[model samples]
Target: MTLTLSHIKKTFNGFTALDDVTLTAPQNQTTVILGPSGSGKSTLLRCANLLEKPDSGTLTIDEESIGFPARLSAGQIRKIRALSSMVFQSFNLFPNLSVIDNITLGPVRVNGQSKQEAQDAAKSLLDKVGLADKADAYPLQLSGGQQQRVAIARALAMNPRYLLFDEPTSALDPELEHEVTKVMAALSAEDASLVVVTHNLRFARKTADKIVFLEHGNIRFDGPADAFFDSDDPRIRQFLSIYDD
Candidate 1:
């Protein structure tokens, strides 16, 4: 299984955010998108799940192309979304809901899963994210990391073929960041296909099977994580300086 985006181009008021961006993410591995701010990393990740429609592109899951620009029927759009679930950096939990409730809402509402069915699956995901005890806790009661893990669990509850992360650890403190990355590391070991947009170079190096670098709304490098680090590209070298490494 794979997720492929080809010839993707997006513009708002004619300001291109992604220009001819093409990426292929194969199954059972992690692909990281790296770039400085305004380099279009988030936009690219958003397009993968149709959260942001590409002005022109062919997004395919497995082998079927789902055109972003085409006026897709509701069913087609739902089918497209079902194939990938997005995890945001902010956690995006409902403040009024308990952790379990937040995780179960999507499956129960969007997937038409009964409450019991959703809860059953959510319990397993809770354990997987090390949040089995936080199920009944409100988002306000949890740390940023715990809340983010709940978000990850919420995405996993859908049992999607791919999980797309938009800088999942960006909002957490370094200690808290470890909590989220640990969960992601466990996910990477499974059959899950992950496409992450992140500025955390250390985490990217640790979890990424493949690294893709973007610059000025264009992709500059695509290769193994180690190779990307060893690249002669000055732009990539400059990124290393941004962090303490």
Candidate 2:
């Protein structure tokens, strides 16, 4: 397993977000977390990255447990975080900074790489996402799709082992959304380990190697993408019906 969530549980003010959720995300494959609103899909993804701390249970990266002030040193925790990159629903690019700056910030600040080295890396990543020409353009100057592509480039600049995408295309227009999806598809093609939280069933079916349907904080089904849509389980069937053809 590239990532494992064992008995992971989290709650906020007595409202449970994740209920003893257990998952084994395979390496070199896209594993999707799919569910309706309030299904704890985003929460689960946040927990894996320690963005939201779970009340109980363990999160392991390649079999090594990690968290704040427990099972890992501060430096080790930072390193672990660097090993995984996350792209949010909203493009979290630095509005004031140019595209290249947004991509170079992490390597220069977190990893202590020289500005020249970071710039070179960021440039390559921007090119990979088809934004090399927009290097000097500010985030506000770009289109929604362009900003999201830059966000993807920023995450890749970190050289992470795995990538987590949380509704990466939800904020774009249909045409722009298609562009972002193509970038995501390209990432999955190049790197097998990609974890995503999305409501796009077409994306789930086309890109996911395994799909885990989440409901009320519990996993209702964990199987191949086709099996999930074709599941005999009534809950799975009913839930999918909302998005089914």
Candidate 1 runs further than 4 Å off:
none
State each model's CA lDDT, in order. 0.89, 0.86
Candidate 1 on 68-130: residue-level lDDT in tens? 688877887788788899999888899999999999998998999999999999999999999
Model 2 earns a TM-score of 0.94
**Local error of candidate 1 at 110, Å?**
2.6
> Any residue pairs clashing in model 2, and if so which?
28-192, 29-192
Give residue 34's lDDT in candidate 2 (0 to 100): 90
Find the 10 residues in a row with the least total lDDT in model 1. Answer: 236-245
Every candidate's CA RMSD: 1.4, 1.9
Predicted candidate 2 versus true structure: per-residue lDDT over 99-140, tens digit per residue: 999999998999898999999998888888888899999999
Model 2 off-target regions past 4 Å? 67-73
What are the TM-scores, per candidate, against the unseen true structure?
A: 0.95, 0.94
